[model samples]
Target chain A: MSAAETTPQRIAGRGAAPQRSLWHVILVRPETMTLVLLVLAVILASQLSPFFLDISYILRSFTLSAEFAIVALVLTMVIIAGEIDLSPAANMALSTCLFAWAQASGVPMPIAIAIGLVAGLAMGALNAFMVIGLQLPSIIVTIGTLTLYRGLAQIIAGDKSIRMPEWFIGIDKVLVFGVPATVAIFVVVSLVLGLILAGTIFGRQIYQIGTNEVAARYAGIRTRRIKLILFLLMGLAAAIAGMLTASRLGSVRYDLGLGGELQMVLMAMLGGTYIFGGRGTILGTFLAAWLLVVVSTGMTVANLLPAIQLTVLGVLLIVAIIATNLIYSRAQR
Target chain B: MNALGRILARRETGIAVMIVLFALAVSLYKPQFLTLNSLRVILLLTPLVMIAAMGQMLVLVARHVDLSIGSMLGLSAMLTGMMFRDLPEIPWGLGFAVSIGIGTLLGLVNGALVTFFRLPSIIVTLGTLNLYRGLTFIVSNARQVDRQFIPADLKGMSQTSPLLGIPWIIFMAFAVALLTYWFAMHTRVGRQIFALGSNPIAAPLRGVKVTQVTLLVFAISGALSGLAGIMYASRWGFVNPSNTGFGFEFQVIAAVVIGGVSINGGVGSVLGVMLGVLLMGCVAAALPLLGIPGTAQSAIYGAVILVALLIDRSVRRQGIARFKAARA
Candidate 1:
């Protein structure tokens, strides 16, 4: 048995024994595959439009994708630890509206920002309370909260635009290394997140809790605390994104991040995160964010109709999700 | 089965009482609300929504939610809208066939995702919701059908009285409701849905083709939404892309859930959904006709949904507590 185990299990094919290791068998990863495809997409996009290679356009697009990338990063933790906050888009919208309104009411910029962030924190706490307290599924609870928050945001905006001053709008536009500050934030945040997810015990605990809550509990992990922390992280990320967006536009609209939930979910899923929880990475999501922004920018720079761009996103999201499911299922086998 | 029967018996008895009370209350306010004209209008509006509620209720019962319903309706309407505009010579029955065909296709998309992709139905439907709407946007592109081009034969049913001064729509609605309720109660897959919803893994282990049933439910839902779309367009005689059916999907979902369909899946009835839809429709038409402010009207719709859900939750809690007590 030991000899058989030590020797590689060779196939019955009539050929030289295939030199292989378990590592070789595990060589193919969906992420690597996606990486190759992304490179191809970039090459194709660059070929399609000369304007796509312009540093300014590239930076501008990355800045646009930054908010989603950052939020998806934080949301990855939430999904990893087994929960979700679909209300973040609505939360961001409401927070932005409130921040702008408060600013207009003569609140200082710093105070307005703090208050805006507090709103998200409060929402996250409320969500944690509802899900943990009521023992309701996160999906259903978040959906309810999504509507409720959006409704409240509408009431706050009241069919009006809430404007912020030029200073806030320009916060993310200032260049670092000739790239927009917003894009810089997304890259730095993703890098930091990658290290933490790969290197930290807290990160391991998150995966533990996500993989099996009961087992995690038995292993002496505080699953509830982990979840609450993840929720707050999501909220904070959403708030930051909202602020950047508000600043970028020089104003806060009622729909500051309207329909962002759709984009965020698509990006996260396309990154190959398991929807049921316990598997994902900031790196994968960052790649997805890059691919999406590049695709969108590439289409626009090429003067392709925006409709087809969306259709591409739609098809890509579906194919990515279906492929991820198949790959994960096969991997399990 | 026993729990289901009990729930149904309780919901039906409760709804029957509430309907009578609501009707009496309305009559007291305006005697005209009791008149044949108003009743006929109510009936006229009932069938399409009833058919839709049945389909929506099925998805809910199977533990999957389809938010793409409005988009489904739009696709069907657009298909027939052009038909009505350019192919007016075509029989109205042909329009129905086309609508159902379109609805089924839309449902298949939703079903395949929910079943084969092994993803959450909400996520799939949510993606498709925008996808469908986006397609509608691309296709409609501010297009409007002329009222003059609308087929009169289809419009006639919206206004015509068939029996007891009741419009044909109500009978059709009631018939659809009856047919679905009977199917859910008697069919093999019907019971399988309940089993799946209650405990999906257990049901599949016990030999239920959960995927097939789930896909079929979603398809039926899509078909029903399509039918609703056609009726809505035929009644209104034009399709306004911006305003037409834009927010109606939310209303349908809210109504279905509040009518005692469990938000968690596996415990809703067609009867409950029908009553919920009617109650919502009444509130929508009556409150405005009574001259309620438009903004307040929208808020009231959300509020009513919340209130209904609260009531349902409270009742469920009580039932569960009682069940535990009995078990003890």
Candidate 2:
């Protein structure tokens, strides 16, 4: 085997590659870098506030980002498949708006919820059709759809916030075993996604497709169909997240998750996902989600303005991607 | 007949035809839409997008995208507005220079990150987009530049017309477009940009200075966005940190794509981009006349982008097929 191939195998601990050492495994892995940063952020965050170490306070803050964390899990999969969907944040808005509008118009709650989920599925189908069926670049196509979806949400909601039924509000307040329901959902979903991505044939094909679609196609993988399914899954996840958001906020507006695409992408990038595709893990994203919550929560507690928070998030995105790319490039060598 | 067919064969002709059809449809519903005053509204509304799209066209042609133009516009506009607010004695024209200079610096930052780190332009600009916007808020202390602080002369650019009753901002936009046309068509460095976009790998082999061209395109994009930000103050008489250039990139990108600028790079023209901006402007102007609310305006812009992508894709496929047949 080539030196590069042997290194990964040796790191997996299945074989002995003489040149491989513990330091190489520790320093070269993108996840290792993420773990280091995550720890630093936690320590720094705890120092910023006396309450930061309290389990209840952390759980409450995690609820604020739980929906996005859930969606980020699917986004990690999509990026690993070599395609991206920038429209999920918009998807959440439109789908939730549809749900709220339907219920406000006197539709039954369950049916309205169904309508919302279906709208999300349809949105995903449209994205799949454009990116896979029409053979267009996912990046540009999603940017277009992102605008389109958000605009539609505005048209539907029209600067008005529709209220949900009283019983439906505050999923964040609903706790199971002292954890918010949304956070529980996030954990469960992350576990499932992480397992699938790491241990399944379907998941392996996704990596193969992302690494090189043409090669994957030649290898008998149904690249187009797999991408379409991933897109659909992304849509479903965004829809579910949107519903959770509405429950947390008690209302739905066109701007429900306004500017959320930035945070979602930030989560994936921070989790050490390779921007160019073919590499990333759900576990990394899971840790990154908590890291981001701690960092932002710490900033909030320190009385920093939202503008500064925005600047910090932007800087973090750049630094994270740069560090991950460097790690990956070095590993390749 | 032959000349007509050749003219029709160009991608710009398709956009022109769409514009005509759209205008006719709107005018038929409301004949007042065809009036000269209404045309002026469309023309007036187009200058900012027109200017920004020229820069975007070049960047897109260079095979890189710049999402930070909107934030660049916001930051530069905020800076200029602050200057006029605090240093009232400074000549208003200096605002243009300052804005453009800051914009160039920001663009160079983007270029440095993309080239030096070999990072993707989209992600870099996305980061800078927020970064620059946040800086704008920080520097301005979240305060908007009020109308009273803006100089009368600066605002007069949008109000006063030296020719054909058109605003000076429109003239400035056209002038920039003209300069861009000359650069893209006549200059060696300009041609090198097209080469870099068409094939980055082959560009180095052909002696194209890939780094220089990429940096230049990004810088130009920033400078133009800066110009647009200044024009925003002229048009609106105020500059709000968050509102000045919000969603501006989408409008410019929609216009550039509609203008037949291939997203894959190496193709576009000043004339096509101009027509694209005009088409978007006409639609925007027609919306209010047709009783369509402002909320639907963005959706239309998004739909227009997708349709343009479809048209661009088909046209490219046909061209490829024709080239193969000729080769065969």
Candidate 1, B267-307: lDDT as tens digits: 98877778877776666556545665444443454455555
True contacts kept of 2: 0.61
lDDT of 1 at A255: 65
Cα-based lDDT for every prediction: 0.76, 0.92
> What's the residue-level lDDT of B191 in candidate 1?
85
Mind giving the per-residue lDDT tens digits that candidate 2 earns over B1-328?
A: 5998999899998889999999999999999999999999999999999999999999999999999999999999999999999999999999999999988889888988888888888888989989998999999999999999999999999999998889899999999999999999899999998999989888877888777888899999999999998999999999998899999999999999999999899999999999999999999999999999999987888898899899989999999999999999
**Candidate 1: regions farther than 4 A off:** A1-27, B1-49, B163-170, B241-243, B282-320
Please give the TM-score for the first chain of candidate 2.
Answer: 0.94
Any idea how many clashes model 2 has? 0
The C-alpha TM-scores of every prediction are: 0.87, 0.97
Every candidate's DockQ is 0.27, 0.55
What TM value does chain A in model 1 reach? 0.90
Q: Which stretches of candidate 2 lie over 4 Å from their true place?
A: A1-19
